[model samples]
Target: MNKRKIEVCLTPVLLPLYDIENSIVVVIDIFRATSSICYGIANGAEAIIPVAKVEDCLNYQQTDCLLAAERDGKVVEGFDFGNSPFAYTEDKVKGKTIVLTTTNGTYAISESRKTAYQVIVGSFLNLDAICNYLQKQDKDVLLLCAGWKNKFNLEDTLFAGAVVTQMGLDNFEYDDSAYAAEDLYLQAKDDLSGYTSKASHGKRMQKLNLEKDIAFCLNHNLTNVIPVLVGDKLVKM
Candidate 1:
């Protein structure tokens, strides 16, 4: 049998170089967006609607959905919350639908939704579940990182590395980027928080006094909920 191929696109800007039509694209935004999505879905939120613009999220204001918008590491004025995972507690989001817009993550989802064979939210929070699901799917995989404002960021790359490491290399062919990510993961696996503290986004989060949020987003296997894009929204799969 031929081995399935796995490639890592370090940033959404480079996504056009990959053949996503036949590959399951795992959208990763480990700083906060995808992490929060996994947390919210696992906590019983019905669905998360990811929009590319803050204005797009505002259109849902009259509806029952919860509105969340984050830009430049801070909550956008007039939104219920930012992309912090702590804001997704079960007591607040259970049975509710959330509309979320972020600086990078949602934009990556919007860009890939039309082309990828499958688009699923990924983060360290659901690492094992994602790896196990990919093993059973038998499809080529694209680890799409939602870098900070279309530029490469360390946290997302590290999570991509973690996935590549967890997925193992025996049954799959990998690209140069995949090998590089795996190497990075192996080097930092023992102390992810300590290693990521040097990342640009991590430093930005620190400037914003979000050390706890950064810590929580880096935790592994916190949930089994995999958020798969279904039309315009992400529902637990």
Candidate 2:
């Protein structure tokens, strides 16, 4: 049998270089956005509508969907909340739809939605579940990191690395980016939180006094829920 291929795109800006035609694209935004999505879904959110722009999220305010918009790591002035995982508790998200827009995560989803065979949200929160799901798909995989402002960020890359490592290297043919990500994962696997604390976004979160949110986002296997993009919204799969 032919081995499935796996590649990692370090930033949204580099997404165009990869051919996503037959690949399952997993969008990673470990700082908060994707993490919150997983938490919300696990908490029973009906669905999450991810829009590329804050203005798009605001447009949903007239509907029953909860509006969430984040820019520069802070909640937009008029939104209900930012991308913090704690804000996605069952009490708030249950049985309701959430419209989310963030600095990098939503943009990454918008770009990948145009061509990938399938798009799914991935993060440390659902690490093992995602790996198991990918192994069953028998398709090439693309780990697309929602880097800070279209530039590479360590947390997203580290989560990509974790997924590649968890999936086991022997199962698929992978590229240099995959190997590099695995190498990074191997080096930091023993101390994910400690190692990623040095990331640029990590420092920014610290400055914003969001250390609790950082800790929550980095925790592994918090839920088995995998958020798959169905049309414009993400629903549990």
Best-matching candidate per lDDT = 1
Q: Model 2, 142-221: lDDT tens per residue?
A: 99999999898888888888888877768888789899998998999899889989999999999999999999998889
CA lDDT, every model vs. true structure? 0.94, 0.93
Off by over 4 Å in 2: none
TM-score of 2: 0.98
Candidate 2's displacement at residue 113, Å, is: 0.6
lDDT (tens digit, per residue) of candidate 1 on 1-237 = 888998999999999888889889999999999999999999999999999999999999899999999999999999999999999999989999999999999999998998999999999999999999999997899999999999998889888888888787788888998999999988999999999999999999999999999999988899888999999999999
Q: Count backbone overlaps in model 1.
A: 0
- Cα lDDT for residue 43, model 1? 96
In model 1, pairs of residues that clash are: none
